[model samples]
Target: MIPLSPEILAALALALLAGLVAGAWPARRRLLAQAAEAARQAERAAQLQDRVAQLERDLSAQADALESWRARAQDGRLELAQLQAAHHEKLAAFEELRQAFDQSRATLRAEFQHLAGQVLEEKSQGFSRSSQDALGSLLRPFREQIESFQRRVNEIHDASVSGQARLDTEIRRVLETGLKMSDEAQSLAMALKGDKKATGNWGEVLLERSLQLAGLIAGDHYQAQASFRDEAGNRRQPDFIVRLPDGKHLIIDSKVSLVDYDRAVSAATPEAREAALVAHVRAVRQHIDDLARKDYSSLTGMKSPGFVLMYLPIEPAYIEAMRRDRELFDHGYRHNVVLVSHTTLMPVLRTVATLWMLARSNEQARALGDQAGGLYRQVEMVAARLQKLGHALGAAAAHYNGTVTAVAGQRGLYGKVGRFAELSAKAGRPLPALEPLLADFEVQRLDGIAPGADHVPETGRADAGSPPGAVPEDLHPPGEPNP
Candidate 1:
């Protein structure tokens, strides 16, 4: 409120200006900082907007890719379904084929069993009746073997029949196990490829199996490894000795070498096969020569034919030998040796058995003829005795009629006996009443043979109570009518 001079006011203004300037400087610094902060916020907001736009574009692209994946999945499902249906069709077709195969197999098996059973039954029935006598002992060893063979054959046939379900399962399993069998076969072939002893043993086993299949009973119909001594005192044994129906023997040799033949089969090249086949043929010829040199036919108890059977257990080996050398079989034949395979020897063994059966049948027939002759002689003696009995009976009937006529004829002992009955009553003791015999009553002759004149009247009369021409019931012989 006090009035001041101008000079004092001017000095105060200068000081106040200085103070305002200091305060304004701080405010300006604050405004400049606020403006810089606002510019940074706007730039950050622009960057955020650009980021949102990029994210939306990315989201849209992902949604389109997702739709494409959904469509591709739908097409894949359709394709998979089609493939599955095709697989099912093929499976159904295969199943039908397998079922048909099983049905056919079953039908064939049933038919085979029926036919074989009929043949076996007929043969067994014939053999049974024929074996009841002396032949029984001869065939005893064979019966059990034949029955066992038949049972094994039946079991094999039964085992061969497989159901459809089993067939399916086996089909699936065979895929896994089939290669294993092939591997085993290869291993076996390798084992026997170069080994001579093992091959020979296998051949011998095959020969024995063939013998069994041919229904030859060992030790009965055939002897295995029967020993014989030559004139030089050397013991020789044949693989098998078949007993012929004529009491002779058949020698079979199973020691044929097949090493070269196995090599021929496994040969890779045609030239190698040719070389191996030539060696096989040479080996076969050598074996034939060896058999012929042994001369089993001349052995003491062999009784074999001029020819000895050289058994080649493998059919292919025999065929290969013959094919390579056309004259191989002829060569063997010339040397008194015959080359035979399993197929050929089976028929020979069967023929020997047939011959034995026929020989036994002839013996049984001869015995039957002798029995028939004896039966006829016995019948003749019985007829003579029956004739003599008839004659004696006729004579007895005549004697009986004569005694009856003497005792009970008119004015005979019966009338006298009737008078004695009254005397017996007067004596207080009744006599036994004697019945009278009729004059027409007579005994009939046996078999309608005419009786003696004293027994029967010249004119024929009916026998006591019998009709004319009727014989007594007890007098008729079996199966014969009365005359």
Candidate 2:
């Protein structure tokens, strides 16, 4: 135990030594690691403090800038709000003023139109009165002369009526005397026995006088042809054959259709009148058929040959008979046969004259159109010059408009301010606020200040003098207090 073997003694010493070294090594390593950790903590603390100080400075500067910006933003917001409110207020007032102006303008236009109508009415009445009075004065002598002629005509008509009655009575008496003696001569007039030359000649005299009054040569323009050849070369004598403008022949057979008139005069009772009317209708039908058989259109190869004017030198009573029979009249018209009585002959002649005039006028108008066309072409150069003049005038107007607008702008500014001063002077005191009650000192809304405004003049003309209401003082009302 005291002295061990060499290996045992060395092992024990080495063991002791190893034990001490191991314990000391662990203690030194622990101390060294603690010191390193402490140094790392100190370096970290320094870096963190520097970072915190930088962060504080940055936050302070940021806070100051944010406050400054907020103040400026608030100020800008206030100003923008004020401008918006003012714009809205101005727009509202302008709309109100515009509506008032439109109403006033409409009222003025209506009043002016009413006054113009009254003036025109009064003027028309005066003109009518003057015309009537002048016509009365001028026609006084003519009216008296007309009355005198009418009286003479009435007296003549009465005398003729009396004489005709006496003649009728004498003729009846003579017929009665003859019927009592010669049975063949019963109720037969001497004229009906072909003993009167005056009856046939009287018709020719009437024809000559009527034609003369109507401006026609009896034989040259129209005449009664006793003998005429038909299309088949058959010799036939019509009452009258008229030569057309183209030398074509037309037949004019004179016949009186007096069915209605005879019925009207001869009927003694209502039943008899009715019976006679029926007979007259049958007779008229027969007459229309007979007239239609006379193919007047075939009388000549004229284009409008079917149209024939059937002449009837008869009284109005006979004409009225045909007129009363609508079927007969329509039948005749449809057959292209225009029945012309003595009363209607003049109108027929006038129609023919108008037709001739129309043809002549048409030819004249065509000639005039071509002649005038050439004259219009000759002035084409002058027309182009006039068009150029019109263009130049438009350009000049544009330039003048620009100048007037510029002048009006400048003048309006100065005039409005000057007028404001003058109005206060005229009132002898400072002006009150421009409120709804005030009638003077119109605002921009009433004046229509905007460009392209409906109330503004399109292009103002130059004027040496000022326009109406240019001076506000002139339009200012007298206040309650004397000025």
Best by TM-score: 1
How do all models score by TM-score?
0.47, 0.29
User: What is the C-alpha lDDT profile of model 2 across 444-474, one tens digit per residue?
Assistant: 2222222122322222221124321121111
Residue 92, candidate 1: alpha-carbon lDDT? 50
lDDT string for model 1 (1-483, tens) is 889999999999999999999989999999999999999999999989977976796577557545643554465345435534644553454344334333433443353354334433532244444434543343343344334433533442343233223433432342343234334433454468677777667666766766665556788788887888999998888888888878888888888877777787688865686788799899999999888888889998668777899987665566557667889999999999999875456556645654664465445334333432332233223233333534454465567667666677676677677677666656465444444323221122212322332343222232355422233222233344332
lDDT of 2 at 196: 33
Q: Name the lDDT value of residue 481 in candidate 1.
A: 37
Q: Model 2 residue 76 lDDT? A: 39
Off by over 4 Å in 1: 1-190, 360-392, 408-483
Clashing pairs in 1: none
Candidate 2 Cα outliers beyond 4 Å, as residue runs: 1-209, 231-233, 244-251, 257-267, 270-281, 300-304, 353-483
The global Cα lDDT (0 to 1) of model 1 is: 0.58
For candidate 2, which ten residues in a row score worst on lDDT? 468-477
